[model samples]
Target: MNPKDWSVSQTLMHAAKIYGEKEALFDLKRRMTYQELDTESGRLAAGLKELGVARGDRIGICLPNWNETVVLFFAAAKIGATLVPFNPMYRSHEIEYILENSKPHVLFISRAFEKQVSLSQAASLVHHVIAVRFKHKGMLSYSEIIDRNEKEMVREPIDVDEDVFCILYTSGTTGMPKGVMTVHRSVVQCAFTVSEEMHCNENDVFIVPAPLFHIFGITCNVMTAIASGARMILLEKYHPKTVLQLIEKEQVTVHQGVPTMFLKELDQEDFINYDLSTLRTGMVGAAPISPEQVQKIRKEMNFELCQSFGITETGSVTITRHDDDEKTITETVGRPLPGITVNIVDENRKPLPPGEVGEIAVYSFGNMKGYYQMPEKTREVLDDEGWFYTGDLGILDEKGNVRFVGRQKELIIRGGLNIYPQEIEAVLLKHPEISEAAVIGLPDDVLGERACAVIQLKPERSCTEDDIKQYVAERIATYKVPENILFSSEFPVTASGKIQKGKLKEQVLEHINA
Candidate 1:
């Protein structure tokens, strides 16, 4: 059977049939084989079905990298339910927005995350709250769901193209998070293509350091593993030495992460101690990596690191070939995947000539369905003809390779995570002590870019850097909080009194440099 025609659940079932008894997932010391995972997912699917989780119902999962996370993913896909994976680091402020917008029928949170994000807060927005690794007074446990039903039930057929697989919330320029409706067809297609691109097979061991909530982890690590029948090692969290140890111990052949993760592992004091010779191929993307850094990774990591470019709106569209030259890997994000059409277009949507920087537009069957409940917003980016005019600026060479230049939208990609300045600006504007706010991205060696807030205070209102940080920290994710807070009685603006972010960023950089 062709993978493109199969649903996410079907992919897992196929892997189970082909590579039964082979280790499929390893989270910490715990492990699960392909057949065990298939059975467990089926059991959980039955429980979810029994609990009124019918087709189209949204199921929210806010947990780190764990075995249950993968199980939940397959179970949701099997029963035709949409999964909404949230970053567990989010505070109540960020979580509340997503919970209300997605309005999930069920939500899964870990015991550790429950302390950070109260179960009661989510209980109001979500119908059922299932806790992992904990059984509270009234909340359901994850074990209960798996054991609630002993047998697999008949599942409704899944429409790979039409039915939504997952709803991923990504911050937008409109100052709110918009849920991108990714379908089963796009995911399955990506899995097959990426697996083939990396030359993955059943004997490969793939270790994932990125958070499962991100598309990079979901598609490249989990979905790709399922497609190729690869053994998976999921790190609960990313640590420099821990990754090196896992790669050495598990003989991880395929790995994927942002540049920061690779840097940390390389910078580990005892980096030479680990035996990473088993590493053969993987991807390094989501944030900018310098040519020098790319060279360092190739020389030190002992793996053929391929640079690729993609967004949550679309799965992995472009990837460098495994046999690419050093210059090609160093300079470009590589050519588009099979059947993927990439166009470098002008502001008017006309295709730009090679070597000219313009908005990158992509046309593929894997593009998102639309922004959930935000049709007007979706219409703005995704045209009627299936072309998604990505707000990213890029230049295409004559060879069809895409080189990313910059972002047209004022967005911050910190450590491979998308953080829209508008969303943070919206939260900053809510601070009682601020009159005007502009959040700008600053250069950073580690995080790629750190946020800095430029604020103009209201007359007679006094606030310090700590006050701003503390206040903003209370309202948004810690990652979104500005690392540098600057106060100015006034800011440069146009005749219309609109803040000039470009001008503000320049001034702030000058001030910080001085």
Candidate 2:
């Protein structure tokens, strides 16, 4: 497929043509061939049109990693609608926030979640809500939509290179989440880059353990599989037992997940009982992994564990190449793929030489247009020179491989989920007893890092850890709540009088461990 001329829909259609009879997607419930997926998605697109959806409209996808969710993604792309995939684990407040921000014309949701969380009552901006069910709902069912609409519709070819294919909202760590606008060309380039580095082929069966809402999961697993004519096995959620069973049952060839996920799976006592011989490649991203874990995985799982480094702003830009040495795969985030360039720059924006630590900047076709609706925030990171400053501090080795370092921002990774320190601090300051607050990330054994809140209470005002935790938990999502709280008389300050967060973090870690 011509990367410039093909839309994401066209890419799927072309895959359907070439591998029409081959299985395209699989779940515990059913297996869909490429031909079936194409027909089903086209029908869903026609149904969406009947319901007044048109080009450039925003469509919210709140379903789990099921066949219907995959179908809706392609259907939206088929009709040139921007897909806004929300995490199914989001509470009503989180869902409402995204609904208001994205302002989707329609929402596709599952009838019930694990705890019977319903979107029908909570979503205000959704004009129409379509429900998928294990049992029939009074409203329109997924099967009904496909059956009622025609199987084939005139696919108006879009300018694949220019059209915005998806608007993926980042998990808000600092404030309200920002929508990252990704174009078709960037998505395709990302898929091709991942597929090439992983040596994906038609015979490869990729297991998707990450949520489809995440860019890494969608682009690396779904789009890469479609572009390479490979098979995709979708699991609703990651359960170590289910994941192991599926891998052995389907003989999955490629596995992709975050570092936290792999850690959880490795901790399972029965992990060694599963037959994982068919697994040839595994990829971890979104968080850093220790060399100890990497060595253990290689010895136990018997597969090449490669790490991927990128963010939503720059779709998976660098990957540990398949043929890279164990040291390269473990120590660095391998070289940039074709058409992508990495630059390490100092405070003045001048490029630093190899082997020096500086801000990691990227110039790539895969970079997003900008943060949606935040020109000021967008300008702060994206420069006029086309380099996107990734707020990460890292060094380039003599061989041009980028090594993993710490982040410049106060973004915390808790079990692969981003927890912004500013967001937590803002919520903590709302307490009546708290006069000042600072949040930091403390290293953890299970999660890569956990949130730690350090606060100076109003003079003579007494508050306990429970009080502080409950105060923040009531305001934000549970994940954003600090796992540790420290009461301090005064925070350490630098010469400029700015609170020294590094020292505060160390203090918090010491206090917690003590």
Candidate 3:
């Protein structure tokens, strides 16, 4: 079958027939082969159907990475339900906002978050709230729904090619989360892009540390592995030691995660104790990466490390190939994927020359249909010409490589000069004592904004604030250097492992007020 014509359900069914008893998923608690995954997922689809969840119905899945999460993903696709996945770590307000916006008829939540999130408020919209592990007085149980003796029943036929597959809510760094409407065609294209670029095969064992709710986990890891008929090891929770143990135990060949995940594993005191020789390639993205971090990953982890640039709207827009040299891999997010076109555009939306920094715009099949029920929000970024103006600032090199500068909102204007946080952060990371660094613009009465550096030092290492400022001053312009330097034991981060710059800015403000 032509891959483009196949829906996610068809793809999984095809894999089940071809791979059969091949191990498909591992979650520490249990394992499922392709056949079992397919059968169980079908059962789930039937169960959902029994509950009146027909095509076009919205279902919310708020669970961690587990065997059931995988089954629910395929089941939703099979039944033509639009799955809206929520980060399991989201608090009450965050969860309520999404629930109110998406209005999924059924919400599948993990019992573990019973204390953190209050779903009672969403009772007006959600007819049934299915708890995964534990049972509550009023909520339904996942096992009860799936054990209805409807395991082998097939779902009714629907137009899978044009139906909405899922709705993924953005991380909402700026404001309330917006749902990105994604169809099966975009997902299939993203899967093919990842499989081809990463050279995935049946023999490959993919290990994913990113949360399943994120696009990186769903498309780049889960869907990509399914497309290639590869084995996938899912981690319910991230512990650097446990992840290292899994790599040795499962003989994980392909590991994909954010830079912080890689750094935590590398910083382990007994990192050398693990047998990571099987690792051949992986990706480190979803956040800014220091060149030092990239170098350490390649030389120490002994893998052909890759970097990428993508957003929830478009999956894997650009990725540095495994065969690329260390400099190219570390320096830029490689040229756009085969079918994706990228351009650096100025404020006026005119394309810019190579080497000039501007807004990164992407045009691709992987682009989302639009933000769900948000025509105004969708039109703000996606232009009439089919271009998605990625609010991120970047530069396309002469070789078509993309160098990410910083978010447009993160740009600091000191008097009349524009200072990018990434440039200052990069200079700080070059300091041997600084392990991780983040730069943010702070309020200044005279300058409009002044740059401040927040840093986490290497273990048992210390450097005076003056010495740190001197290091950056020696390399960049005097105006670009951070006016204030502060030490942090850790930076506030999102579930997907991105440093929360807005939260960090608030921390600075609080400190000044105190």
Candidate 4:
């Protein structure tokens, strides 16, 4: 069968037939083979069909990394239903907004978060509320869906080339989170591209510590592993010691996580005690990693690191190759992936020169269908010509590699000079005493906005604000030095391990007020 004609459901059936006995998924409580995965998903699909779910129906999934999460994703694809993945960390108001917007027929939620998320408030929008780990008083149980021992239903053929497979809500840093409509074709294409680029295959054991709800985890980890027929180790929660232990226990080869996760693991005093020799290839993305950390990960973690740059709107954009040199891997996110075209454009949407920093625009099969129910907003970012203005600032080198600067909204204009926060943050991270750093634009009456640096120091390391200011001044121009410096033990992060700079800016404002 031609790969372009293949749907996610078709991929699962193929994997089950070809690698029936191979281990497919491992979680805290259970391990499943490909055959088991296929059977369980079939049972759930049959149950969902019996519950009035039809083609194009939406099913909301709000759970952590588990075997069930994998099953539901496949089951939704098999039955032609669109999966709506929800971040498990969202509060009641946030959850309510998504539920009201998507209006899924069924919502599968973790029982542990019932109180925190106030499930009852959103129950009206969803016809059925299926609790995963434990049964709620008025909710259905996951076992009830899987216990229906109906004969394995034969999967139907989907367009595969064009069909909405999932709706993932964006991490709302600007306003209300938008529901991104991701199709089967784009998902398959992006997953295959990432797997091929990373050299993943059946023998590889992939571990994903990132959240299943996020696109990075779904595309690069779950979908990529399935596309390659590789084994997957899912973590319900992240702990530095536990993850290191799993790498040793499972002999994990391919691992993926954000820079913060890697930084934490390396900071673990006993990280070297674990056997990580099995690791061969892994990726760091979703947040910026300094060149210093890249060297540290390569020298200490013993893995061929691939640095990536991507967004929820586009699947896997640019990724450093396995054989890429240290300068390319550390300094730039490698050229665009297969079937993807990227360029830097000025404010007028005209393409910019190779060395000039501008908005990063992309044209690819991996771009989302559109923002669900927001045509105006979709048209604003994704133009009529099919280019997606990423609202990110970057410069493309003559060799085609992209050097990510920072978010356009995060740009600081102080005294008529432009300051990219990522540039400042990268320099701050290079400081020996600083473990993590975030730079944000603060309100300044004279300059309109002043640059502020917030840093988290390494354990037992000490540095005064003057020392940090001097270190940055010596490395860069005086105008770029942050007018304000604040220290914290940790920065606020989203579910996908990205530093929430907007929140950090708010914290700085509160400090100034205090």
Candidate 5:
């Protein structure tokens, strides 16, 4: 069958039939083959069906990169339900916003989150809450659901193209979370394209350090691996030592992560001791990948590290091919993928000449179906012609390569996570002592950038940096909390009285450097 006709669920069946005995996943210490994964996932689909999860029902998962997540992915697709994944790092406030917005019928969450997140906050939002990893009273069990006599699930026939399989919630400029809806066709086609572009095959064994909930882990890592029948070594969390050990232990050929991960691994004290010779090609994106880092990855790590530029709104549209030169791989995000149209535009939205920095806009089949229940917000970015006006600034070179400059909006990419300044600013404003606040990304040697919050007190009110960090940490993901906090009596503003972040960033950097 043509790849376009294959749904996410169909992809699994094909993998199982063709590579039944091939080791599909090396998750934690558990080993599962293609056939076992397919079988267990089918049992999970039956259990979900037993729980009244029908086609089109939305299922939410807030778990880490465990074997269950891999099983649940195909399980949701097999039953034709939309899987809404939440970052496990999200606290109650962040989780509640997305939980209320997506309104999933069933939520499979980790028990570890039970203490941090008050499930009662989600009691009204979600229909059912199932606990994974730990057993809890008054909650359904993941083990109970799947531990049953079941084979391939008899799924009801449906329109694959029309059915939405995943709804990814990404924070918007306004600090509100918007659910990005993606249909099966886009995901399958994108995965097929990624497999073809990366030349991935059954022989490829990759390690996923990126979270499964994130776009990089979902479409680019998980779906692509499934499409190509490649083996995966999943990590619970990113640890430089463990990652290096796994790469050598599993003979991981393709490694995908952000600049921070690569830097950490390369900077490990015993970095040279590992046998990473099996490494061939992989992607390094989400944060800046310096030219020097690219060379290190090639010479030291023994892989042609590729760079790709993409957003959750549109799947990876530009990716560096293996044949591309080191300069192209380091400097540009690569030429546009097949069937993707990208252009740089000025403020007026007119196309700019090659090499001119402007807002990067993308038109591709990989573009999201739309933001769920957010037509007005969706219209703001995605136009009628399917061109997504990405707020990111970049330059489309004459060779059709995309060179990312910076974000038009204040987006702080610490490690590989995208964080909006406005979101942190909103949290800072919520502080009882703070009158006005601004959050900006500061250049960092590691993690690419870190958030710094500069604030003014309300009259004589006072709060230490730890107080502010603790406040924000309790409200949102700890990763989104400002690493550096500064108190200021005044802030740089425009003539109209809006805080000028550009000037604020300049002043902050000057103060730090001095």
Candidate 6:
């Protein structure tokens, strides 16, 4: 499939022709076939063109996970406009930054969230702000465009593989979010890789409980399912009960989410009562999962729990094969997917030996083009050799399986000792009382940096800081044990459900200095 030969809309058009009456998308309100999706997206695209949107223009989509949001994505693609998906959790400040940075030609928002957020407040940066609902005053309603526009316009012929498909902005942990430019080729390649590795088929129904703004949710869950002609069930929010209900009701065969999501679902009292026998493939990624957790998921959930590894920069990279032994599945992330290359290297860019920990780099068709408008930042990580330095540390075993240790930036340097938080965290999770844990590096006057462990314990289960430190000290070297331990009812988290270690580090340093 030549990605450059067709636009994202053309890809859908092709699918619609093949799948036609097959169910393509399902939400709480309605179920849409591939043909229905194609017609609606075409109408929306024509509507966008009437509003002065042209090729290469940026269109901001701020709606939640719904059938409309998916329609807008393909609609913008049909017109050769780049779809800029924003997190629905963003408030004014965050939305303001993205709108200003992208300078979108048209902003499509929902008036449903206007009670909590006002699109009128951000009217300065946007040329045209259209409301998906009628609650927001002084903006065109979504029906005004799609309902009235003619849906007979031809799909724009774009360099399907090379032209930018979507500009996904990163969640700004350090500063303002950077827009990641991904082409059609990258999206299609990633979808193909995920479908191939997971063995997704037309019969598979993918249940997506994650938010649509995230790349993992969009690429792995949305695009991958569409590429495979599989039905996708979209959830507005992730309630454990809702997820289980959807699985049983939809007969979902493939489920994908982060470890935290799986843990939360398991914690639900009614979790075991649900009829999830239809589920055959379960995938957890975006953050590290302990081998014990994987085992529990397999035993309790009764689904094959496969651990994969990837990031926003590189779409699905490595996946645990279904045929692998339990030990290999638990220990490594499996080999790189076909057409993907994994390399571990030191600071000097020299490839490291197997079993050595270093920065994990990847070369794949799924890699993002680069950071939008940030050439220096793009070049800093992506070298001339086509390798994207992941800023993550991992080791390749003798059999060429990759085991992620930690992120290089998150590595704690305590008195010249390098401690990976994931290692300590895995050990801490083994403790009976501990349900979740985050290890961070805190500033130390004498040692330069000290390790701190923040834990969220099981309800009513109590543990002191000394107990945690003692527990880790007995399992690992003394230097690797945390210098301080803190307990929290809840830890900060990212949109993708990973623990926000950076935020926890800030909280730890504030208390230690106080």
TM per candidate comes to 0.82, 0.80, 0.97, 0.98, 0.81, 0.97
| Backbone clashes in model 3, listed as residue pairs | none
Steric clash count of candidate 4: 0
Residues 40-120, model 1: lDDT tens digits: 999999989887898999999998899999999999999999999988877678788889999999999887776566767
**TM accuracy, model 1:** 0.82
**RMSD after Cα superposition, model 2:** 10.9
Ranking by TM-score: 4, 3, 6, 1, 5, 2
* Residue 269 in model 1: lDDT: 79
Alpha carbon lDDT of each predicted model: 0.85, 0.80, 0.88, 0.89, 0.83, 0.85
State residue 489's C-alpha deviation in candidate 3, in Å: 1.3
lDDT of 4 by residue, 46-163 (tens): 8888888889999999999999999999999988999999888898889889999999999898876676566667677789889897977867788888986466656766876568
lDDT of 6 by residue, 359-432 (tens): 99999887888998899999998988779999999999987789999989899898898999999999999999
The count of backbone overlaps in candidate 3 is 0
Higher-TM-score candidate of 1 and 2: 1
Kindly give the stretch of ten consecutive residues in candidate 2 with the minimal lDDT sum.
Answer: 493-502
- How far does residue 12 in candidate 4 sit from its true spot (Å)? 0.9
Worst lDDT run of 10 residues, candidate 5, spans 492-501
Q: For model 5, how does the per-residue alpha-carbon lDDT over 13-67 read when each residue is reduced to its tens digit?
A: 8999999999999887699999999999999999988888989999999888999
User: Model 6 clash tally?
Assistant: 4
* Model 6 ranges off by over 4 Å: 1-7, 112-117
**Shift of residue 134 alpha carbon in model 3, Å:** 2.3
